[model samples]
Target chain A: MKLTESLSFRNIKGRPVRTAVLIALTAIMAMSAICGSLAVMSLRNGLGALEARLGADIMTVPASAVSKQDFENIVLQGSKGYFYMDRSYYDKIAEREGIEKISYQLYLASASAGCCSVPLQIIGYDPDTDFTVSPWIRKSAGGELKELDVVVGNDLSVFVGETITFYGVTCNVKAKLDKTGNDLDTAVYTDIGTIKRLIAASLELGMNDFKDIDPDKVVSCVLIKVADGYSVDEVLNDLNLHVRRTKSFKTTDMISGVSESLAGVSGIIGILMAAVWVLVLVILFLAVYMSVNERKKEFAVLRVAGASRSRLAGIVMSETLIITITGAVIGIFLGLLMILPFNGLIEESTGLPFLLPDTLHIIICAFVALAASVIAGMLSSLGSAKRISRIDTGVILRGDN
Target chain B: MTITATGVCKDFIRQGKNTNKLTAVSPTDITIEAGKLYVLMGRSGSGKTTLLNMLAGLLTPSSGKVLCDGEDIYALDDEKLSRFRCEHIGVIPQGQTAVHSLNVLENICLSYMLYGSLKEREAAYPAARELMRKLGIAGLENEMPSALSGGELRRVAIARAMLRKPDVLFADEPTCDLDDENTALVLQTLKETAQSSTAVFVVTHERDAVGYADICLNMSGGSIGKQ
Candidate 1:
């Protein structure tokens, strides 16, 4: 070590309590800043992915399901829910003037037994007409899904060539979809024919609530894309005015609620980060200032020993740099431990999609946080450095204040 | 080496309400010549320390000049003057003083370390050990300053001041915390340093210190005169 570094190190080691306090304060500041930024960025990324995955302008669900809020629970939270309207609704929606395309899906919630630990939301879409799930399936599965073949979400523990059973029917896992950072990752998807067989098996086992329901005659929901030059709101109004025993709403309306929750969460985190930074910076400033003042005689003695003013300042800054850099690295590592492993828990608690940003983004955020913490430490000690450098060596060494 | 101060005086502005400037030292001329022990005797606040500080290059006089080897020390900037002091001047201030974190040996070797002289540091240990042995602090080199008693700390300061073998050495109350045996030992070391051609100036209240002096001066009411 250089002489200045050795001196600074000894100064830090001499005051254990003060050193620990400064390190801890900077650690908290770094943790809050990094975790807060990651959380906000992940949420926005998850929301964006969800919007692209929806792949529809509007959705129509059974009036009963809408009234009971079951459709929201199923789609937004991946809760185990199955509500059906007549398959004729697909034809009815296709006949609407502003309708550009239409498709139907059947939802079947599986019991949390057999190969699954948690209940899975199984969605079956018509292979011939699906614009949303099929495109993703082609990307992951590489081709059309054969009979009894299933595509699993990223959160599923099952891998390709594995089989998951639902209601005594075993299905092959063809591929796994990428993460959407929401409850959608907990779902399973298949073609309409396979879901119909599962529905029939469920009905026979007395696992279904609707006893008279026929799988071939019912659809859980209808997804529609409006034609170009036609207003989505206008078409939505026409559906609600003409359709019977069902309700249609814009897909954006459902997303807005999630967006609002995300905004609230992000704001709370931002406020918390700001408050921690301000408090840490203030305490650091006062701590450094008071510490230098208390050591006036030591500095004066150093001056008597022929230390220049700038060298004295250099010693203080070196100590500050060591503490801040150490604290920032520790805090960032702890943040990764907390956020990376428990992302699902965070999503569950916040009820918001929580996808982590890409690797480069995370790395950049950590570096920025590290730099900010070091800057804060240096800035806080700047005043004290200047004050100590300019001490009146003669008066102080003479025992005059 | 010799330090010459001509028409040197100092004034401090008393802080707080009813503030006024007070002269700490009166304009005076003095020369500290090599190979002599000069003892300055005075009561507390008699400006003995102030004058000592000016000669040590630690304080700037309000008027006139202090020259060491034909260069005005006060005229140099902080960098140049501090380097000058490091190479030529050594000071032992009043009361206990140490870089508290460093051990006794490290404190004694601080003169070389402050200037980052790697070669000097390589040679400082043997020289420091010699000084510590002479001051009867040989076994305490590894101990911290806080672990030593007041007298031991005073000896450590003396050892540190002499480590660089500087041209001019100043001590304020160098024997304030020592027993008779240690006090004699310290005074003898100062006299020896003078005999070896370094100018040694001591500010003290002890009458015993006068016995070791080649020249004795007294200060009263901010003015200096021969004792």
Candidate 2:
């Protein structure tokens, strides 16, 4: 008899109710794994798009602090002459060999009322070369730079067509940008000259906000974009070394540093999922082991019928492959069905986009599950098949009868 | 051809205590001609079943060699010995146990398919159909083993054992659980199959089976024929 034929017949022999229960468990394991994996993929994709859109590719802030600290500190600490960047140096570095382009925007705000009047970041950029603000600016302005006009980001768009006073100067929102689902969505965009005028005017009038403003301040910090072939780390190292020579110029004080939390989140999820996979492995092991235990008589009969050890093991493995593979395929299908309906909702909430599993993931998952099932079945059958092989058939006949 | 065994001893450490070393048919030589019906009668735990197992190549004797056509079966390795039994010897264990998954027809068909020559198998269906008809189980061929009664199952088991036209047949209690009618029918089938030059060895406590035997070996004292 063919090894597969026997195994197939055996796998299907149990009562319908019993078989269904076992298959359902396998399906759950498969579906749960796929769901977890897809969640990871969706989140990572969202975070990636967000990161690329954010101006923080590498923030230049005081080296001691990371994250929002640089933006906030540069605003708070005025006379300390610390956290300061000469905004004019941005244009000079834009001409550097390895640098692509630089963007510098000063956050300008004025106290209005309550929480609704939170200090807004005012982004300033050169019209021709800025890719950083181009997305939001294009959306809000309806066109490229028209001198003196300003664009607002998504969060600020609710106040569209409304004018807000800051430092006693009123700037009307010319247009509102589509939501990028990031902090930039809350900021305002204008040209470099417009922000410089606001800061200078505020300082000259000695407005409460302008009393602490640095008159000689050029740009808070330059946004450095390295050319395609040049390394950012190498450029930063060179720039820092050159900038450190001046007593008042603090290269370390200006650079914010790299953020690794996104990568860290992915790693943590991976470890947690691995632990879950180990538990699934244990379940798989038990299922295979139990099937072997139940089929002791069958294995013994086949062995006495002269089946070799390898062929007997083949029988067990064939059954496992059928079960595991069938379960996994059904699982992916069920998982897709489960996640797809809520896909848009998740994307909306998490700021992440999701993609359907492709043919490659299906093929690879099938191959992996099959291999795992076969190996697990082979291992589980070891003791039972051995016992069958060594059974004294004459005694079994006597005892059994 | 006939099977012969001399000075066979088999030991067993039964139940972790009893050192039951069975010297079944020990130093006793017997042979029956081809195409004969033979019976061994014994009580429970007697060595008659063990002796039949050795003849069927299911067990190895401690000392003696079982020769069929002058070839010692025990000398062959496990696979070769199993192949020999599959081709040349048939066995019916105690109780009319059936391979329950396969229906009556498939059960008989599989037995012949395992041992029949390729050409013989090409014509197997007709032969099996004829056997079923003769045994009055032709209509039950599609029924699973569990659906059959004790008597019906015994007839089916006998049909399966005789499927390959083996040279030697070993049956343990072929009619043990059958009524008078089924038992007689079973003996009649054995007698008919023996016409093809197959020597049938039957182990039973019942005398009805002994009446069909050309020779009787009564096993006692872990030996055969009372010395």
Candidate 3:
């Protein structure tokens, strides 16, 4: 070791209690910064994925089959539920003047059956007409979903080529979607033919929600994209006015509520981070100040032994750097352990989308957290270093107060 | 190098109701020449320590200039003056002054480590070991300050001060904590250091230190006079 490093290590080792406390304080600072930033970033990434996934400009659902809130809960909160409307609504919506393109999906809530560990929200889309879920599915599954082939959400424990029976109908898992950090992560997706088979199987078991409804002629909801030059509100009004026994609304309206909730959550996280930083900064400053005061005589001896004022300051800063860096690495590692392994728990608890950023983004966050901790260490120690460096060597050595 | 203090004095403000100023050392002139051992003897509370501090560049006098080899040390900024002290002055402060964290060998070589390059500091180990051997603490190099007795620590300080072969060396109460045998050993080392062409200044209440001095001085009421 260099002389300064050896000296700093000895000084740190000489006072075990003080050094531990300072290190603990820095650790807490770094931990909070990393955890808080990762949480906020994950929520943002999840929300962005959700917005992109909800590709339709407007949607129509059966008025008596599902409440608007319940439909939103199924889509946004990943709640396990299903509803059906007559397939004729899809034709009516397609005939509307402002409707540019239209598609409909069927939803089936599955019971805990073969290879399934829990109840799941099963979404069946028409591969021929889909504009939203198809693009995402192809990105992962690499091809069109075939008969009896299932593309599972990221959160499912099932893997590719694994066969899972829903309502006694067997299907092979084609691919697993990437995480959306929402209820979608827990959902299963399949093509229209497989969904009809599952529905027929459920009907034979007397487990279907609407026993009288025809499985082949029913859809859960109709998704529509407004043509250019037509406002979404105008088409939405036209659909509600002309369509019967159905509710029509803009998709943005649903997302706006989610956006508000996200804003509130982000605000609270920001406030918490600010509070932690301010409190830690003050405590760190005082800790450094008191440590210098306690070691005043030692510094005076260094002065008497020909250490310059700046040299004394350098010694103190070096010690601070060592402590802060050690604390930062430990804290960041702990944060990664907590967040990466239990992201589902966090998403459920916060009721917010919690997709972790890509590897590059995570590395950036770590660097930012490390920088914050080191800067805090340096800033807190600066005053103490200056004070000790400028101490009256003669008086201190003479044991004067 | 010779150090000369001209019209130097120190006054500290008494921190009480009146904010009255107390003069610690009166305005006086003194010159320290190389190759001599000068002992400043006085009672407790005499200004001997303050005068020694001014001459060693550790303390700035409230008035007048302290010149070393024709350059005013007090006129130089803290950086230059501290470097000057590191290069030419070595002070063994009064009382226990070890940097408790470092072991004996590290403490002894602290002067060289302060401003020397890594290679230069490494090269100083041999000289430091020689000083430790002469001071009778050769085998205690790895011991901490807390593990040593009062006199051993004093020898360590002496070894540290002499490590640089400084042009001027100041020993404050160098034998205050020693028995007769150790006291004789320390005073003889200072006297021998002086004979080798390094100026040595010592402040003490021990009369035994007087015999080792080439020139003895006395301080009373913040003023100095030849004894």
DockQ of each: 0.63, 0.18, 0.53
Q: Pairs clashing in candidate 1?
A: none
A128-161 per-residue lDDT for model 3 (tens digits): 8998789889998999999989988888888898
Q: What is candidate 2's lDDT per residue for A1-401, written digit by digit as tens? A: 44333534544553344455545656665666666666666555444444445543334443332344334334211111223445445545555567766665455553443322345666666665566767756755677756546776655644756775545556777788654334445566788677667676566565556555553465555566667887766776666555542111223222222124334545675677566556656766676567665655545444433344455565566555566566666766787777757765654454332333455864565455445434443454455445445656677666556
Q: List the candidate 2 regions with Cα displacement exceeding 4 Å.
A: A1-7, A10-15, A29-295, A298-313, A335-362, B15-33, B112-123
By TM-score, the candidates rank as: 1, 3, 2
**DockQ of candidate 1, scored on C-alphas against the true complex (2 decimals):** 0.63
- Compared with the true structure, all predictions reach lDDT values of 0.87, 0.61, 0.85
**A26-113: candidate 1 lDDT, tens digit per residue:** 8988888789999999999989978878888989999888877546758655656888889888788889889888898888888876
Candidate ranking under lDDT, highest first, comes to 1, 3, 2
Report the lDDT tens digits of candidate 1 across residue range B1-227.
99999999998888773468888899989999999999999988889999999999999999989999889998999999999988899898888888888888988888766776566675789999999999999989889888999999988889988999999999999999999999999999999999999999999998999999999999998899999
| Per-residue lDDT over B52-167 for candidate 3, one digit per residue giving the tens place of the 0 to 100 score | 99899988999978999999998888888888888899998888778888888889888766776667777888888888888888899888899999889888888888888899
State which candidate has the highest TM-score: 1
